[model samples]
Target chain A: QQPVQSPQAVILREGEDAVINCSSSKALYSVHWYRQKHGEAPVFLMILLKGGEQKGHDKISASFNEKKQQSSLYLTASQLSYSGTYFCGTYQGAQKLVFGQGTRLTINP
Target chain B: IAGITQAPTSQILAAGRRMTLRCTQDMRHNAMYWYRQDLGLGLRLIHYSNTAGTTGKGEVPDGYSVSRANTDDFPLTLASAVPSQTSVYFCASSDSWGRSLHFGNGTRLTVT
Candidate 1:
């Protein structure tokens, strides 16, 4: 099943912060975050594994809650380059990954 | 480094025509996947291969077929193209199921 994402769209200032959430009905062993620019493919950002702690890259961070079966992406001090469609792909012992509808984020100067 | 590559970056096909989207990965991953993305919709799985000879249907596999003849290649074929299949197709490979996957640039297919 496809995961659900909240805040279909979000607008942020250069120094603002935003959070995007992803949830799945089925138990998820891992959640992968990706960002896609216009007319381009989705690029892998980070992955949260089962029974593991959260991880981050630069100003981008994520948390995975196994009990809630959800993951959240945090964009701190958002930059203009952060503008893109963010997608969270969920995996649960399946050969294919299921992506969310995506959250369109636009960061302005 | 050549991670993953896809042929015919974009294509225009007539309805009812046969088309094949080729995908190749040099990472030697054990799992490969094909997905289609439509405007304002999430990426839907078309087909996937756990190994060289194993294939499985995905969320939206009715209009497509896939084959993993070797570890480095997983190609998707459309026996009969339709307007509904007009979308961006992406190929991905992972070391194992439920692991992080690397994606290709994607092929944009237009069915007229």
Candidate 2:
């Protein structure tokens, strides 16, 4: 099943913080995050497999909750380069991945 | 280093015509996938192959077909074009199971 993403769109200024959430109705084995700029391919940011694990680098981080079948991506101290469309992909059985509708993040100076 | 390459950066097809989107990966990943992205609806899986010689239907496989004859290439064919088929198609591959994917730049196809 396709995961549901919250905050269809968000606007923020430089140095602000934002959180994008994705949740599924069925059980999930893994959650993947990707960011895509207009007219470009999606670039993978990270993937979380463990229920209670959190991972990230630089100013981005993510939290996965296996029990609730939910994942949240955190963006701190946002920069102008951070403006893009964020997608959350939920890995299903047999290596199938379904992506959410996406959240458009706009960061201004 | 071309991780993944998709042919015909953009194309325009007439209805009822057959067209194929080409994809090749140099990473030698065992898994390959085809997804189509549309405005507002996001990316939808069209087809996938776990390994060479095996293919499976994805969430939105209707009207589209894919073949994985080898590890380096996965091609998607549309038997008959329809206006609704107009979208940006992306090719992606991963090492296996849940590995991170390497995506192609994508092919923008317009069906008229």
Candidate 3:
């Protein structure tokens, strides 16, 4: 099933912090976080498995809660390059991934 | 090496015409997927293949067909193109099911 993302859109100052949440109705096997800038392909940021493991990329970090079937992405000291659409993809025992509606994040100077 | 390559980076087709978007991966991944991205709709999976010669429908498979005759290629076809199908199509692959995916640049298709 497709996950639900919170705060469909957000605007932050260059140094501000933000958190994006992804929640699924079905049990999840893994959760992936991707960011897509205009006119570019979606790039993989990180993946969180169902065992409470966490991963980070630069100033971005993510946490997965297996029991709640939810995950959260944290972006600290946002930069202008962070402006883009963020998607959370969820996998539930299948070969295919279901992606969320996406969160459009804008970081301004 | 090209992780994944999608042909006709962009295309414009007549509403009733047939079109095919080609995708190839050199990573030797065991799984491949096709997805369409529309404004405000995020990315919706159209079809997927776990291995060569095996294909399965995804969330939005209507009006689209896919075949995986080999591990390196997966092409999506539209029998009769519709305006609603105009969007950016992405092809991705992973070593196995539920693994991290690597995506191609994408094909921007417009059904006029």
Q: Point out where model 1 deviates above 4 Å.
A: none
Per-candidate TM-scores read 0.96, 0.98, 0.97
After aligning candidate 3 to the native by TM-score, how far in Å is the CA of B40 from where it should be?
Answer: 0.7
lDDT of 1 by residue, A5-109 (tens): 999999999999999999999987889999999888888899998774689999999999878899999999999999999999986456668899999999999
Put down candidate 1 lDDT per residue, B44-90, tens digits, no spaces: 88888998999998889998998888899999999999999999999
Ranking by TM-score: 2, 3, 1
For model 3, the stretches where C-alpha displacement exceeds 4 angstroms are none
lDDT of 2 by residue, A1-109 (tens): 7899999999999999999999999987789999999889999999999757999868999999999989999999999999999999987667688899999999989
TM-score of 1: 0.96
Two-chain DockQ for model 3: 0.84
True contacts kept of each: 0.86, 0.75, 0.86
Can you write out model 2's per-residue Cα lDDT over B2-30, one digit (the tens) per residue? 79999999999999999999999999899
Q: What does chain B score (TM) in every candidate?
A: 0.96, 0.97, 0.97
lDDT of 2 at A81: 93
Per-residue alpha-carbon lDDT of candidate 3 for residues B1-112, written as tens digits (9 for 90 to 100): 5799999899999999999999999989989999999998899999999999999989999999999999999999999999999999999999875568899999999999
